[model samples]
Target: MTRTSLRGVIAAIVTPATPGLDPDAPRFLRHARQLLAEGADGLNVLGTTGEATSFSLDQRRGLMEAAAAGLPRDRLMVGTGAAATRDAVELTRHAGDCGFAGALVLPPFYYKGVGTEGILRYFDAIAEGSAASGIPLYLYNFPALSGVPYTEDLVSALVARFGGRIAGLKDSSGDIGYARRIAALPGGLDVFPSSEAVLDQARAGGPFAGCISATVNVSARHAAAALHGGDDAALQRATAIRALFDGKPLVPWLKQAVAARMGDPGYGPVLPPFVPPDPAAVATLVTELEKIDKAPARP
Candidate 1:
Protein backbone atom coordinates (compact mmCIF):
# COMPACT_ATOMS: atom_id res chain seq x y z
CA MET A 1 0.00 0.00 0.00
CA THR A 2 1.11 3.53 -0.71
CA ARG A 3 2.08 5.55 2.36
CA THR A 4 -0.07 8.55 1.48
CA SER A 5 -1.78 10.46 4.26
CA LEU A 6 -4.76 11.43 2.10
CA ARG A 7 -5.94 7.94 1.25
CA GLY A 8 -9.07 6.32 2.73
CA VAL A 9 -12.71 7.33 3.27
CA ILE A 10 -12.72 11.12 3.45
CA ALA A 11 -15.88 13.12 4.08
CA ALA A 12 -16.66 16.11 1.91
CA ILE A 13 -18.08 17.92 4.91
CA VAL A 14 -20.87 20.47 4.57
CA THR A 15 -20.65 23.87 6.22
CA PRO A 16 -23.12 24.33 9.02
CA ALA A 17 -25.00 27.60 9.17
CA THR A 18 -27.09 29.65 11.58
CA PRO A 19 -30.75 30.30 10.73
CA GLY A 20 -29.60 33.69 9.44
CA LEU A 21 -27.18 31.80 7.10
CA ASP A 22 -24.00 32.77 8.85
CA PRO A 23 -21.18 30.19 8.79
CA ASP A 24 -21.42 28.52 12.19
CA ALA A 25 -17.74 27.79 12.77
CA PRO A 26 -18.12 25.83 16.01
CA ARG A 27 -20.99 23.68 14.77
CA PHE A 28 -19.23 23.21 11.45
CA LEU A 29 -16.11 21.73 13.08
CA ARG A 30 -18.29 19.67 15.41
CA HIS A 31 -20.02 18.08 12.43
CA ALA A 32 -16.61 17.51 10.82
CA ARG A 33 -15.30 15.83 13.98
CA GLN A 34 -18.48 13.76 14.05
CA LEU A 35 -17.67 12.46 10.56
CA LEU A 36 -14.23 11.35 11.76
CA ALA A 37 -15.89 9.53 14.65
CA GLU A 38 -18.29 7.88 12.17
CA GLY A 39 -15.30 6.18 10.45
CA ALA A 40 -14.01 8.79 8.03
CA ASP A 41 -10.25 8.54 7.78
CA GLY A 42 -9.95 12.19 6.82
CA LEU A 43 -11.93 15.37 6.09
CA ASN A 44 -12.15 17.41 2.86
CA VAL A 45 -13.56 20.70 3.99
CA LEU A 46 -14.98 23.63 1.89
CA GLY A 47 -15.86 21.38 -1.02
CA THR A 48 -18.79 21.56 -3.47
CA THR A 49 -20.85 19.96 -0.71
CA GLY A 50 -19.65 22.84 1.45
CA GLU A 51 -20.66 25.60 -0.99
CA ALA A 52 -17.06 26.92 -0.79
CA THR A 53 -17.44 29.54 -3.47
CA SER A 54 -20.53 30.88 -1.75
CA PHE A 55 -18.58 31.53 1.41
CA SER A 56 -16.07 34.37 1.73
CA LEU A 57 -12.34 33.74 2.00
CA ASP A 58 -12.45 34.50 5.70
CA GLN A 59 -15.05 31.84 6.21
CA ARG A 60 -13.07 29.37 4.12
CA ARG A 61 -9.88 30.02 6.08
CA GLY A 62 -11.84 29.76 9.29
CA LEU A 63 -12.98 26.26 8.39
CA MET A 64 -9.42 25.14 7.60
CA GLU A 65 -8.12 26.70 10.78
CA ALA A 66 -10.87 25.01 12.79
CA ALA A 67 -10.16 21.66 11.19
CA ALA A 68 -6.45 22.09 11.86
CA ALA A 69 -7.08 23.09 15.44
CA GLY A 70 -9.65 20.35 16.06
CA LEU A 71 -8.38 17.36 14.05
CA PRO A 72 -5.09 15.95 12.92
CA ARG A 73 -3.70 18.32 10.28
CA ASP A 74 -2.37 15.46 8.17
CA ARG A 75 -5.95 14.16 7.80
CA LEU A 76 -7.28 17.39 6.28
CA MET A 77 -7.69 18.28 2.60
CA VAL A 78 -9.05 21.74 1.88
CA GLY A 79 -10.87 22.84 -1.29
CA THR A 80 -8.91 25.96 -2.29
CA GLY A 81 -9.84 26.78 -5.87
CA ALA A 82 -11.77 29.92 -6.67
CA ALA A 83 -13.05 31.92 -9.66
CA ALA A 84 -10.02 34.14 -9.22
CA THR A 85 -6.57 32.65 -9.36
CA ARG A 86 -5.29 34.84 -6.52
CA ASP A 87 -8.00 33.59 -4.19
CA ALA A 88 -7.05 30.02 -4.96
CA VAL A 89 -3.41 30.81 -4.30
CA GLU A 90 -4.25 32.52 -1.05
CA LEU A 91 -6.34 29.60 0.11
CA THR A 92 -3.76 27.05 -0.98
CA ARG A 93 -1.10 28.96 0.91
CA HIS A 94 -3.28 28.84 3.98
CA ALA A 95 -3.52 25.06 3.64
CA GLY A 96 0.24 24.90 3.46
CA ASP A 97 0.52 27.19 6.44
CA CYS A 98 -1.94 25.05 8.38
CA GLY A 99 0.02 21.88 7.54
CA PHE A 100 -2.97 20.36 5.77
CA ALA A 101 -2.13 17.20 3.85
CA GLY A 102 -3.65 18.23 0.53
CA ALA A 103 -5.80 20.64 -1.48
CA LEU A 104 -8.77 19.79 -3.80
CA VAL A 105 -8.66 22.54 -6.43
CA LEU A 106 -11.35 23.48 -8.95
CA PRO A 107 -10.17 25.14 -12.16
CA PRO A 108 -10.82 28.79 -12.86
CA PHE A 109 -14.43 28.11 -13.74
CA TYR A 110 -16.12 31.37 -14.73
CA TYR A 111 -15.22 31.17 -18.42
CA LYS A 112 -16.37 28.25 -20.52
CA GLY A 113 -14.63 26.59 -23.50
CA VAL A 114 -11.11 27.18 -22.21
CA GLY A 115 -8.37 25.59 -24.27
CA THR A 116 -6.46 22.65 -22.86
CA GLU A 117 -3.32 24.72 -22.60
CA GLY A 118 -5.31 27.46 -20.88
CA ILE A 119 -6.60 25.05 -18.26
CA LEU A 120 -3.10 23.71 -17.83
CA ARG A 121 -1.81 27.22 -17.30
CA TYR A 122 -4.56 27.84 -14.79
CA PHE A 123 -3.31 24.97 -12.66
CA ASP A 124 0.25 26.02 -13.31
CA ALA A 125 -0.56 29.46 -11.99
CA ILE A 126 -2.17 28.00 -8.91
CA ALA A 127 0.85 25.83 -8.28
CA GLU A 128 3.36 28.62 -8.81
CA GLY A 129 1.28 31.22 -7.02
CA SER A 130 0.82 29.00 -4.01
CA ALA A 131 4.56 29.41 -3.34
CA ALA A 132 4.53 26.57 -0.84
CA SER A 133 6.25 23.19 -1.02
CA GLY A 134 4.97 19.73 0.00
CA ILE A 135 1.31 20.72 -0.11
CA PRO A 136 -0.25 17.92 -2.17
CA LEU A 137 -2.76 19.15 -4.75
CA TYR A 138 -5.64 17.20 -6.25
CA LEU A 139 -7.51 18.50 -9.26
CA TYR A 140 -11.23 18.64 -8.59
CA ASN A 141 -12.54 17.26 -11.91
CA PHE A 142 -16.21 18.28 -11.94
CA PRO A 143 -17.30 19.25 -15.44
CA ALA A 144 -21.01 19.14 -14.64
CA LEU A 145 -20.79 22.11 -12.33
CA SER A 146 -17.53 23.84 -13.27
CA GLY A 147 -17.74 23.28 -17.06
CA VAL A 148 -14.16 22.12 -16.61
CA PRO A 149 -12.63 18.70 -17.06
CA TYR A 150 -9.02 17.76 -16.34
CA THR A 151 -7.77 16.09 -19.51
CA GLU A 152 -5.36 13.20 -19.27
CA ASP A 153 -2.72 15.16 -21.12
CA LEU A 154 -2.94 18.08 -18.73
CA VAL A 155 -2.80 15.80 -15.74
CA SER A 156 0.17 13.94 -17.18
CA ALA A 157 1.98 17.20 -17.74
CA LEU A 158 1.25 18.33 -14.19
CA VAL A 159 2.55 15.11 -12.71
CA ALA A 160 5.68 15.21 -14.81
CA ARG A 161 6.40 18.77 -13.82
CA PHE A 162 5.33 18.78 -10.19
CA GLY A 163 5.34 15.09 -9.21
CA GLY A 164 4.83 14.85 -5.45
CA ARG A 165 3.06 18.18 -5.10
CA ILE A 166 0.54 17.35 -7.85
CA ALA A 167 -0.52 14.37 -5.78
CA GLY A 168 -3.83 13.09 -7.17
CA LEU A 169 -7.28 13.72 -8.64
CA LYS A 170 -10.93 13.61 -7.55
CA ASP A 171 -13.15 12.74 -10.49
CA SER A 172 -16.57 14.02 -9.55
CA SER A 173 -17.26 13.82 -13.24
CA GLY A 174 -19.33 10.80 -12.10
CA ASP A 175 -17.92 8.66 -14.89
CA ILE A 176 -16.22 5.59 -13.54
CA GLY A 177 -14.61 4.86 -16.89
CA TYR A 178 -12.99 8.27 -17.02
CA ALA A 179 -11.87 7.94 -13.44
CA ARG A 180 -10.40 4.49 -14.10
CA ARG A 181 -8.49 5.86 -17.06
CA ILE A 182 -6.86 8.47 -14.87
CA ALA A 183 -6.22 5.89 -12.20
CA ALA A 184 -4.36 3.79 -14.76
CA LEU A 185 -2.00 6.62 -15.59
CA PRO A 186 1.68 5.87 -15.29
CA GLY A 187 3.72 7.15 -12.34
CA GLY A 188 1.26 5.95 -9.68
CA LEU A 189 -1.26 8.75 -9.65
CA ASP A 190 -3.77 8.55 -6.83
CA VAL A 191 -7.33 8.45 -8.18
CA PHE A 192 -10.58 8.82 -6.29
CA PRO A 193 -13.93 8.46 -7.98
CA SER A 194 -16.58 10.88 -6.76
CA SER A 195 -18.66 8.24 -5.00
CA GLU A 196 -18.18 5.15 -2.86
CA ALA A 197 -20.56 3.24 -5.20
CA VAL A 198 -17.53 2.43 -7.38
CA LEU A 199 -15.34 1.28 -4.50
CA ASP A 200 -15.83 -2.46 -5.07
CA GLN A 201 -14.69 -2.27 -8.68
CA ALA A 202 -11.90 0.16 -7.83
CA ARG A 203 -10.75 -2.11 -5.06
CA ALA A 204 -10.80 -5.13 -7.36
CA GLY A 205 -9.05 -3.39 -10.27
CA GLY A 206 -7.52 -0.64 -8.28
CA PRO A 207 -5.78 2.56 -9.16
CA PHE A 208 -8.01 4.08 -6.51
CA ALA A 209 -6.39 5.74 -3.55
CA GLY A 210 -9.79 6.03 -1.84
CA CYS A 211 -12.97 8.09 -1.99
CA ILE A 212 -13.75 11.69 -1.05
CA SER A 213 -17.51 11.69 -0.94
CA ALA A 214 -20.51 13.68 0.24
CA THR A 215 -22.14 10.29 0.86
CA VAL A 216 -19.45 9.54 3.45
CA ASN A 217 -20.75 12.40 5.59
CA VAL A 218 -23.28 9.88 6.92
CA SER A 219 -22.31 6.57 5.30
CA ALA A 220 -18.67 6.52 6.45
CA ARG A 221 -18.88 3.13 8.13
CA HIS A 222 -20.38 1.47 5.07
CA ALA A 223 -18.12 3.36 2.65
CA ALA A 224 -15.13 2.36 4.73
CA ALA A 225 -16.30 -1.26 4.49
CA ALA A 226 -16.41 -1.03 0.69
CA LEU A 227 -12.84 0.31 0.54
CA HIS A 228 -11.25 -1.85 3.21
CA GLY A 229 -12.90 -4.97 1.81
CA GLY A 230 -15.38 -5.69 -0.94
CA ASP A 231 -18.30 -5.75 1.48
CA ASP A 232 -21.11 -6.00 -1.03
CA ALA A 233 -23.88 -5.66 1.55
CA ALA A 234 -22.32 -2.57 3.09
CA LEU A 235 -21.76 -1.10 -0.33
CA GLN A 236 -25.35 -1.93 -1.25
CA ARG A 237 -26.72 -0.10 1.77
CA ALA A 238 -24.36 2.81 1.14
CA THR A 239 -25.53 3.13 -2.44
CA ALA A 240 -29.14 2.91 -1.27
CA ILE A 241 -28.54 5.86 1.03
CA ARG A 242 -27.01 7.82 -1.87
CA ALA A 243 -29.81 6.82 -4.26
CA LEU A 244 -32.40 8.48 -2.07
CA PHE A 245 -31.36 11.81 -3.61
CA ASP A 246 -32.23 10.74 -7.14
CA GLY A 247 -33.88 14.03 -8.04
CA LYS A 248 -32.82 16.30 -5.22
CA PRO A 249 -29.69 18.48 -5.07
CA LEU A 250 -26.94 16.49 -3.31
CA VAL A 251 -25.42 19.19 -1.07
CA PRO A 252 -28.64 20.26 0.61
CA TRP A 253 -29.87 16.71 1.01
CA LEU A 254 -26.53 15.67 2.55
CA LYS A 255 -26.77 18.55 5.02
CA GLN A 256 -30.31 17.53 5.90
CA ALA A 257 -29.16 13.99 6.58
CA VAL A 258 -26.37 15.28 8.82
CA ALA A 259 -28.77 17.52 10.71
CA ALA A 260 -31.26 14.70 11.17
CA ARG A 261 -28.52 12.41 12.43
CA MET A 262 -26.98 14.97 14.77
CA GLY A 263 -30.33 16.17 16.04
CA ASP A 264 -29.23 19.62 14.98
CA PRO A 265 -31.29 21.25 12.27
CA GLY A 266 -28.68 23.96 11.81
CA TYR A 267 -26.86 21.76 9.33
CA GLY A 268 -29.80 21.86 6.92
CA PRO A 269 -29.68 25.50 5.88
CA VAL A 270 -27.87 26.30 2.62
CA LEU A 271 -26.79 29.55 1.03
CA PRO A 272 -28.60 31.73 -1.50
CA PRO A 273 -29.60 29.95 -4.74
CA PHE A 274 -29.90 26.71 -2.75
CA VAL A 275 -32.41 25.78 -0.07
CA PRO A 276 -32.97 22.91 2.32
CA PRO A 277 -34.78 19.83 1.12
CA ASP A 278 -38.56 20.29 1.36
CA PRO A 279 -40.53 18.33 3.96
CA ALA A 280 -41.94 15.73 1.55
CA ALA A 281 -38.59 14.98 -0.02
CA VAL A 282 -36.94 14.82 3.39
CA ALA A 283 -39.54 12.29 4.49
CA THR A 284 -38.87 10.00 1.55
CA LEU A 285 -35.13 10.29 1.97
CA VAL A 286 -35.26 9.55 5.69
CA THR A 287 -37.64 6.62 5.26
CA GLU A 288 -35.44 4.91 2.66
CA LEU A 289 -32.27 5.63 4.65
CA GLU A 290 -33.76 4.24 7.88
CA LYS A 291 -34.76 1.02 6.15
CA ILE A 292 -31.20 0.57 4.91
CA ASP A 293 -29.83 1.36 8.36
CA LYS A 294 -31.72 -1.50 10.02
CA ALA A 295 -30.86 -4.07 7.35
CA PRO A 296 -28.30 -6.78 8.11
CA ALA A 297 -24.70 -6.17 6.97
CA ARG A 298 -23.32 -9.11 5.01
CA PRO A 299 -22.18 -9.66 1.50
Candidate 2:
Protein backbone atom coordinates (compact mmCIF):
# COMPACT_ATOMS: atom_id res chain seq x y z
CA MET A 1 0.00 0.00 0.00
CA THR A 2 1.34 3.43 -0.93
CA ARG A 3 1.16 6.31 1.58
CA THR A 4 0.86 10.00 0.77
CA SER A 5 1.73 13.07 2.77
CA LEU A 6 -1.17 13.89 5.14
CA ARG A 7 -1.89 17.60 5.40
CA GLY A 8 -4.63 20.20 5.96
CA VAL A 9 -7.16 20.16 8.83
CA ILE A 10 -6.98 16.71 10.37
CA ALA A 11 -9.45 16.07 13.15
CA ALA A 12 -8.28 14.25 16.24
CA ILE A 13 -11.62 12.51 16.21
CA VAL A 14 -13.50 11.11 19.20
CA THR A 15 -14.26 7.42 19.43
CA PRO A 16 -17.86 6.45 20.01
CA ALA A 17 -18.33 3.87 22.72
CA THR A 18 -20.86 1.10 23.10
CA PRO A 19 -22.72 0.34 26.33
CA GLY A 20 -19.82 -2.03 26.92
CA LEU A 21 -17.34 0.75 25.98
CA ASP A 22 -15.68 -1.40 23.34
CA PRO A 23 -15.81 1.05 20.39
CA ASP A 24 -19.07 1.01 18.53
CA ALA A 25 -17.83 0.42 14.95
CA PRO A 26 -21.01 1.54 13.22
CA ARG A 27 -21.25 4.71 15.24
CA PHE A 28 -17.54 5.27 14.83
CA LEU A 29 -17.75 5.05 11.05
CA ARG A 30 -20.80 7.31 10.97
CA HIS A 31 -19.00 9.99 12.93
CA ALA A 32 -15.87 9.67 10.82
CA ARG A 33 -17.79 10.00 7.56
CA GLN A 34 -19.63 12.98 8.92
CA LEU A 35 -16.38 14.72 9.90
CA LEU A 36 -14.90 14.21 6.44
CA ALA A 37 -18.07 15.48 4.83
CA GLU A 38 -18.06 18.43 7.19
CA GLY A 39 -14.60 19.40 5.76
CA ALA A 40 -11.86 17.63 7.72
CA ASP A 41 -9.05 16.77 5.35
CA GLY A 42 -8.24 13.67 7.35
CA LEU A 43 -9.06 11.88 10.59
CA ASN A 44 -6.55 11.10 13.38
CA VAL A 45 -8.09 8.09 15.03
CA LEU A 46 -7.20 6.88 18.57
CA GLY A 47 -5.05 9.93 19.26
CA THR A 48 -5.16 11.74 22.61
CA THR A 49 -8.60 13.11 21.87
CA GLY A 50 -9.67 9.60 20.96
CA GLU A 51 -8.40 8.25 24.34
CA ALA A 52 -5.95 5.88 22.64
CA THR A 53 -4.07 4.81 25.75
CA SER A 54 -7.28 3.84 27.54
CA PHE A 55 -7.96 1.00 25.10
CA SER A 56 -6.15 -2.33 24.76
CA LEU A 57 -4.11 -3.42 21.76
CA ASP A 58 -6.97 -5.55 20.49
CA GLN A 59 -9.44 -2.72 20.83
CA ARG A 60 -7.22 -0.25 18.97
CA ARG A 61 -6.55 -2.69 16.17
CA GLY A 62 -10.24 -3.54 15.90
CA LEU A 63 -11.24 0.09 15.54
CA MET A 64 -8.45 0.68 13.03
CA GLU A 65 -9.48 -2.29 10.93
CA ALA A 66 -13.08 -1.15 10.93
CA ALA A 67 -12.10 2.36 9.87
CA ALA A 68 -9.79 1.21 7.09
CA ALA A 69 -12.47 -1.06 5.70
CA GLY A 70 -15.10 1.66 5.80
CA LEU A 71 -13.30 4.97 5.23
CA PRO A 72 -10.84 6.20 2.66
CA ARG A 73 -7.48 4.81 3.75
CA ASP A 74 -5.34 7.70 2.51
CA ARG A 75 -7.11 10.20 4.76
CA LEU A 76 -6.63 8.29 8.02
CA MET A 77 -3.75 8.47 10.48
CA VAL A 78 -4.08 6.21 13.52
CA GLY A 79 -2.34 6.67 16.87
CA THR A 80 -0.22 3.56 17.52
CA GLY A 81 1.85 4.72 20.44
CA ALA A 82 2.03 2.45 23.47
CA ALA A 83 4.07 2.38 26.65
CA ALA A 84 5.37 -1.02 25.50
CA THR A 85 7.66 -1.13 22.48
CA ARG A 86 6.27 -4.46 21.32
CA ASP A 87 2.70 -3.21 21.57
CA ALA A 88 3.50 -0.01 19.68
CA VAL A 89 5.18 -2.01 16.95
CA GLU A 90 2.27 -4.41 16.69
CA LEU A 91 -0.32 -1.66 16.55
CA THR A 92 1.73 0.27 13.99
CA ARG A 93 2.19 -2.81 11.85
CA HIS A 94 -1.54 -3.45 12.05
CA ALA A 95 -2.14 0.15 10.95
CA GLY A 96 0.09 -0.38 7.92
CA ASP A 97 -1.60 -3.68 7.21
CA CYS A 98 -4.93 -1.85 7.26
CA GLY A 99 -3.48 0.70 4.78
CA PHE A 100 -3.54 3.80 6.94
CA ALA A 101 -1.63 6.84 5.63
CA GLY A 102 0.59 7.10 8.70
CA ALA A 103 1.05 6.17 12.38
CA LEU A 104 1.19 8.87 15.09
CA VAL A 105 3.45 7.60 17.90
CA LEU A 106 4.09 8.96 21.38
CA PRO A 107 7.31 8.28 23.26
CA PRO A 108 7.33 5.84 26.19
CA PHE A 109 5.40 7.73 28.85
CA TYR A 110 5.33 5.42 31.88
CA TYR A 111 8.98 5.95 32.83
CA LYS A 112 10.09 9.51 33.44
CA GLY A 113 13.69 10.72 33.02
CA VAL A 114 14.79 7.96 30.66
CA GLY A 115 16.49 10.73 28.70
CA THR A 116 16.73 11.12 24.95
CA GLU A 117 18.78 7.99 24.33
CA GLY A 118 16.07 5.79 25.83
CA ILE A 119 13.40 7.51 23.75
CA LEU A 120 15.58 7.13 20.65
CA ARG A 121 15.95 3.40 21.30
CA TYR A 122 12.19 3.08 21.72
CA PHE A 123 11.65 4.71 18.29
CA ASP A 124 14.53 2.65 16.86
CA ALA A 125 12.67 -0.50 17.79
CA ILE A 126 9.49 0.87 16.27
CA ALA A 127 11.29 1.74 13.02
CA GLU A 128 13.10 -1.61 12.83
CA GLY A 129 9.98 -3.63 13.67
CA SER A 130 7.64 -1.81 11.32
CA ALA A 131 10.19 -1.38 8.53
CA ALA A 132 8.72 -4.18 6.51
CA SER A 133 5.32 -2.50 6.73
CA GLY A 134 6.81 0.78 5.40
CA ILE A 135 4.34 2.93 7.31
CA PRO A 136 5.49 6.51 7.87
CA LEU A 137 5.76 7.45 11.56
CA TYR A 138 4.59 10.83 12.86
CA LEU A 139 6.05 11.50 16.31
CA TYR A 140 3.46 12.73 18.83
CA ASN A 141 5.04 15.37 21.11
CA PHE A 142 2.66 16.14 23.94
CA PRO A 143 5.14 16.47 26.82
CA ALA A 144 2.64 17.58 29.43
CA LEU A 145 0.74 14.30 29.42
CA SER A 146 3.67 12.00 28.55
CA GLY A 147 6.30 13.69 30.75
CA VAL A 148 8.79 12.91 27.98
CA PRO A 149 9.40 15.76 25.60
CA TYR A 150 11.17 15.08 22.32
CA THR A 151 13.84 17.73 22.49
CA GLU A 152 15.27 19.38 19.37
CA ASP A 153 18.41 17.24 19.41
CA LEU A 154 16.31 14.14 19.90
CA VAL A 155 14.07 15.02 16.94
CA SER A 156 17.05 15.83 14.75
CA ALA A 157 18.73 12.58 15.77
CA LEU A 158 15.63 10.53 14.95
CA VAL A 159 15.22 12.25 11.59
CA ALA A 160 18.92 11.81 10.79
CA ARG A 161 18.87 8.13 11.68
CA PHE A 162 15.45 7.05 10.41
CA GLY A 163 15.16 9.47 7.45
CA GLY A 164 11.77 9.31 5.74
CA ARG A 165 10.57 6.52 8.00
CA ILE A 166 10.33 9.24 10.67
CA ALA A 167 7.61 11.10 8.80
CA GLY A 168 6.47 14.06 10.94
CA LEU A 169 5.75 15.36 14.44
CA LYS A 170 2.58 16.61 16.11
CA ASP A 171 3.45 19.32 18.66
CA SER A 172 0.59 19.36 21.12
CA SER A 173 2.90 21.17 23.48
CA GLY A 174 0.99 24.19 22.10
CA ASP A 175 4.32 25.79 21.28
CA ILE A 176 4.33 27.00 17.68
CA GLY A 177 7.94 28.16 17.81
CA TYR A 178 9.16 24.66 18.60
CA ALA A 179 6.91 23.23 15.94
CA ARG A 180 8.21 25.77 13.42
CA ARG A 181 11.81 24.78 14.15
CA ILE A 182 10.94 21.14 13.53
CA ALA A 183 9.13 22.06 10.34
CA ALA A 184 12.20 24.00 9.13
CA LEU A 185 14.40 20.92 9.52
CA PRO A 186 16.49 19.99 6.49
CA GLY A 187 14.48 16.89 5.77
CA GLY A 188 10.99 17.34 4.37
CA LEU A 189 9.32 16.32 7.61
CA ASP A 190 5.72 17.49 7.86
CA VAL A 191 5.37 19.29 11.19
CA PHE A 192 1.74 19.70 12.28
CA PRO A 193 1.07 22.17 15.07
CA SER A 194 -1.91 21.12 17.18
CA SER A 195 -4.08 24.21 16.83
CA GLU A 196 -6.48 25.80 14.35
CA ALA A 197 -4.96 29.20 15.13
CA VAL A 198 -2.04 28.32 12.84
CA LEU A 199 -4.24 27.64 9.83
CA ASP A 200 -3.63 31.05 8.28
CA GLN A 201 0.13 30.58 8.39
CA ALA A 202 -0.15 27.11 6.93
CA ARG A 203 -2.51 28.33 4.20
CA ALA A 204 0.02 31.00 3.27
CA GLY A 205 2.47 28.17 2.43
CA GLY A 206 4.45 28.60 5.61
CA PRO A 207 6.58 25.88 7.22
CA PHE A 208 3.71 24.09 8.94
CA ALA A 209 2.22 21.24 6.95
CA GLY A 210 -1.17 21.83 8.56
CA CYS A 211 -2.95 21.38 11.87
CA ILE A 212 -3.95 18.31 13.89
CA SER A 213 -6.56 19.55 16.32
CA ALA A 214 -9.11 18.07 18.72
CA THR A 215 -11.39 21.06 18.22
CA VAL A 216 -11.52 20.31 14.51
CA ASN A 217 -14.06 17.64 15.47
CA VAL A 218 -16.58 20.42 16.06
CA SER A 219 -15.18 23.16 13.84
CA ALA A 220 -14.08 21.35 10.70
CA ARG A 221 -16.01 23.63 8.34
CA HIS A 222 -14.54 26.77 9.86
CA ALA A 223 -11.07 25.19 9.99
CA ALA A 224 -11.19 24.15 6.35
CA ALA A 225 -12.42 27.56 5.32
CA ALA A 226 -9.67 29.25 7.27
CA LEU A 227 -6.91 26.92 6.13
CA HIS A 228 -7.81 26.89 2.45
CA GLY A 229 -9.37 30.28 1.92
CA GLY A 230 -7.53 32.54 4.35
CA ASP A 231 -10.83 33.27 6.03
CA ASP A 232 -9.95 35.21 9.17
CA ALA A 233 -13.52 35.14 10.39
CA ALA A 234 -13.59 31.34 10.20
CA LEU A 235 -10.20 31.18 11.88
CA GLN A 236 -11.44 33.43 14.67
CA ARG A 237 -14.49 31.25 15.18
CA ALA A 238 -12.41 28.06 15.32
CA THR A 239 -9.98 29.65 17.73
CA ALA A 240 -12.86 30.87 19.90
CA ILE A 241 -14.38 27.40 20.09
CA ARG A 242 -11.02 25.95 21.10
CA ALA A 243 -10.47 28.63 23.74
CA LEU A 244 -13.76 27.75 25.44
CA PHE A 245 -12.28 24.42 26.58
CA ASP A 246 -9.44 26.17 28.38
CA GLY A 247 -8.71 24.74 31.89
CA LYS A 248 -11.63 22.35 31.61
CA PRO A 249 -11.46 18.62 30.86
CA LEU A 250 -11.11 18.61 27.05
CA VAL A 251 -12.18 15.05 26.29
CA PRO A 252 -15.51 15.29 28.10
CA TRP A 253 -16.31 18.66 26.64
CA LEU A 254 -15.48 17.45 23.14
CA LYS A 255 -17.45 14.26 23.65
CA GLN A 256 -20.41 16.13 25.05
CA ALA A 257 -20.46 18.58 22.18
CA VAL A 258 -20.17 15.76 19.69
CA ALA A 259 -23.03 13.86 21.37
CA ALA A 260 -25.23 16.90 21.53
CA ARG A 261 -24.62 17.80 17.90
CA MET A 262 -24.70 14.30 16.51
CA GLY A 263 -27.70 13.39 18.70
CA ASP A 264 -25.95 10.20 19.78
CA PRO A 265 -25.73 9.97 23.56
CA GLY A 266 -23.38 6.99 23.18
CA TYR A 267 -20.65 9.52 22.42
CA GLY A 268 -21.16 11.12 25.84
CA PRO A 269 -19.44 8.64 28.17
CA VAL A 270 -15.69 8.92 28.40
CA LEU A 271 -13.26 6.20 29.48
CA PRO A 272 -12.26 6.18 33.15
CA PRO A 273 -9.79 8.76 34.51
CA PHE A 274 -12.00 11.31 32.66
CA VAL A 275 -15.36 12.10 34.14
CA PRO A 276 -18.23 13.48 32.07
CA PRO A 277 -18.76 17.24 32.12
CA ASP A 278 -21.81 18.64 33.89
CA PRO A 279 -24.95 18.78 31.77
CA ALA A 280 -25.28 22.46 32.56
CA ALA A 281 -21.74 23.08 31.35
CA VAL A 282 -22.34 21.02 28.23
CA ALA A 283 -25.54 22.95 27.55
CA THR A 284 -23.71 26.23 27.92
CA LEU A 285 -20.90 25.00 25.66
CA VAL A 286 -23.31 23.90 22.96
CA THR A 287 -25.16 27.19 23.16
CA GLU A 288 -21.94 29.17 22.80
CA LEU A 289 -20.81 27.01 19.91
CA GLU A 290 -24.14 27.62 18.19
CA LYS A 291 -23.66 31.34 18.57
CA ILE A 292 -20.19 31.06 17.07
CA ASP A 293 -21.60 29.10 14.18
CA LYS A 294 -24.36 31.62 13.58
CA ALA A 295 -22.64 34.93 14.31
CA PRO A 296 -21.77 37.00 11.22
CA ALA A 297 -18.19 37.50 10.20
CA ARG A 298 -16.35 40.56 11.52
CA PRO A 299 -16.75 43.79 9.51
lDDT scores for all predictions? 0.82, 0.90
Candidate 1 lDDT by residue in tens digits, 1-299: 13459888888888887776667888987887777787788888899988899888988888788788988888888999988888988899889889898899998899988887777777777778666555788889999989977888878887787777778899888888888888888767788887878777667556788888888888888888777767888888788887877677888888888888888887788898886668787877877787887788662
Which regions in candidate 2 have their CA more than 4 angstroms from the true location?
Answer: 1-3
lDDT of 2 by residue, 168-213 (tens): 8899998888998888887768889999999988876688878999
Q: Estimate each model's TM-score.
A: 0.94, 0.97
TM-score winner among the candidates?
A: 2
What is the total number of backbone clashes in candidate 1?
0
Candidate 2: Cα lDDT at 87: 97
Q: Over all chains combined, what TM-score does candidate 1 have?
A: 0.94
Error of 2 at 199 (Å): 0.4
